[model samples]
Target: MMDIIDLKKKAAEIRIRLFQMIHNAKAGHTGGSLSNTDILTVLYYHTMRHNPQEPKWVERDRFIASKGHSVESLWCILADLGYFPKSELETFSQFGTRLIGHPNNKVPGIEMNTGALGHGLPISVGMALAGKRDHKDYRVFCLMGDGEQAEGSIWEAAMSASHYKLDNLVGIIDRNSLQISGNTENVMGLDPLDKKWEAFGWHVVSIDGNDIVSLMETFNSIPYTEGKPTLIIANTVKGKGVSFAENAIGWHHRVPSDEELALAIKELTEQIESLVSKEGQPHE
Candidate 1:
């Protein structure tokens, strides 16, 4: 298990990588990607079981970035994990690059291609069902956007997963509050989200999505209920860790300018340095 400071340092590096990748692509989802960095960091570096060298290991855990626009963060983590060469990240969104704006299963570590809202949970349900039927211990993790809950299909998949008693499945909602057009609450309210999931028979946990400790604890506690899937409502800021982008809806799909990119990188570097310093000290 990585200490909190080490985990935070990894997250900062991921953020820096995310900024550089998107900036180089000149077109990518920055807001959503930044929002979910800490969660992805925890999953990849600490909580989840995965093999970078053999991505197809049947018993290895599966993670689907259901909100595919947030692929920037996932891409960087995949690169850091050695699933693909970091050099390939520079081709994100290029005309013929496999690293298009959304996730493509053709990409080495991606389990499924997803971009359209409400698609991931259903696919995850299928994966989880297969694992259960085959008696595989591998867990299926799906990350969805808060706005996606407005989709009826999400509820349908949730119902199906509950009925099947898929204890090995875990759904994480990146509750960042903003979507492409506007605030999720204004578009379609999903308040009392935890209650809603509980009513659907899921074991629900809520946490500060940007906190490494909270993220690790929530993710590690999966399958908490005896016969139910788990839902983690991760509250997050849309443009986390970037000064001008945080909580700013305009950055959702906007690529940062060179100046903005420099600033964001500097911030991330400072964060990484701080974490490194903390890591060097003895724990209290």
Candidate 2:
């Protein structure tokens, strides 16, 4: 039951840790990971019911990183939660490491092998459907990239989730507006995305994805409408929080230089400090 302030501080810490991981790896998706950090922070720390010690807890809420390229933030969060040794983060992206560039089910916290884009949501629909069949109350959360919306399979899965009345299924789009090639609109044209999801029978909500408070508020009120899947269009800035990289298209998969990494860390550290200063004070 963390307050908004603690959640905000945790998100900053996650951003700092994830940056360190990507910088150490020297080969990782930087922008999307940064963009989705707050969303992950809120789900892991405040909203979702999960167990680091018991990764297979049947009653725990399930999460699928449908937009799996930006796994750096997820890896940091998993390690920080003790799903594995935090020291293993140094081995990320190395040859022969479980911590590769994508989500591998071999990892304790991961539920599926993803990163092919368009596959995660389909798989999540199955998981959600299974939960319903078993009469389980756990929720399934699928985090998708706005750029991934161009995949036809995503629409198929969206229709399936809603058709089954899987109100337990929650889909969050990290609408950062940028992908590997460039702007998503220029690439695949997914504008009016919220309306599109609603058309498929999902209850839709749009919010600033990077805002910790907004993310917390949105996630806390899941399944916004009864008997419908929930879709949150989390509008966000790619490469969020890093001053030089914010909204920069080149950072989609670009590794930061040593100087850039240092500067990013400095900025994130200052953010942590600022949040800490307001810790004991009253929150609005």
Candidate 3:
């Protein structure tokens, strides 16, 4: 297991890199990306069994970015992990770049092209079922946004995943409370979200999505019940790492200004330095 301090350091690095990408691209779903950075850091660095060198390795665990709009964080992680040249991140959202506003299969690590919302879970269910039918041990992880829960297709897919007893499937919701329009509850009430998934037959576990320790622990304990899929309701704050953006509805997809970018970078850098100092490691 990776040390908690190390994981926290990596997540802060990722946040800084992602914000730089967003700042350069001048477009991104800022809040959601920040909110989910820790969740993704744990999965890619600690929980998931994947190889950047052999992206299509049959035995590799699969990840589907269901809430695909907030893909900058994933992009930065993949680049850092050698999925692609780190220099390529500079092309994000540029014309003719594979790193578009949403997940694109053209990228090595992305399992599917998503951003339509409501499609990731359904596709993940199919993948999990396929893994079962083939007798493969590979697990399928699908990350979705809280706002996306309102889509009827999500419920249908939830029902199917449970009915099929796809224990290999793990569904994660970035429950940041805010969405593009406004607060999720104001747009479409989805309180008692965990209970709803439980009713659909998933084994629900709620945790602080921003806490890397919690994320590592939760993901390490997959298929909470043998015959059921696991649903992690990751309660997170939108724009998590940036002081000005944290929990702010306006930051959902808002690009950071030059000053905001500098400030965010400074804040995240301090966090990285703090962690490194405690660990007695020289800051790179």
Better of 2 and 3 by lDDT: 3
lDDT comparison, 1 vs 2, better candidate: 2
My TM-score estimates for the predictions, one after another, are: 0.97, 0.98, 0.97
**Clash pairs of candidate 1?**
none
User: How much is 5 displaced in model 3, in angstroms?
Assistant: 1.2
Per-residue CA lDDT of model 2 for 1-284, tens digit only, reads 67888887777788888888888888999999999999998999999999998999999999999999999999999998999999999999998999999999999999998988899999989999999999999999999999899999999999999899999999999999998888889998998898899999999999999988889889888878988999999999999999999999999998888899899989988988898889889885
Candidate lDDT values, in order = 0.91, 0.91, 0.93
- Mind giving the per-residue lDDT tens digits that candidate 3 earns over 67-185? 99999999999999999999999999999999999999999988999999999999999999999999999999999999999999999999999999999999999999999999999
Q: Rank the candidates by lDDT, best first.
A: 3, 2, 1
Which portions of model 1 show Cα errors greater than 4 Å? none
> Over the stretch 59-94, how does candidate 1's per-residue lDDT look in tens digits?
899998989988999999999889999899888889
The lowest-lDDT stretch of 10 consecutive residues in candidate 2 is 1-10
The number of the candidate with the highest TM-score is 2
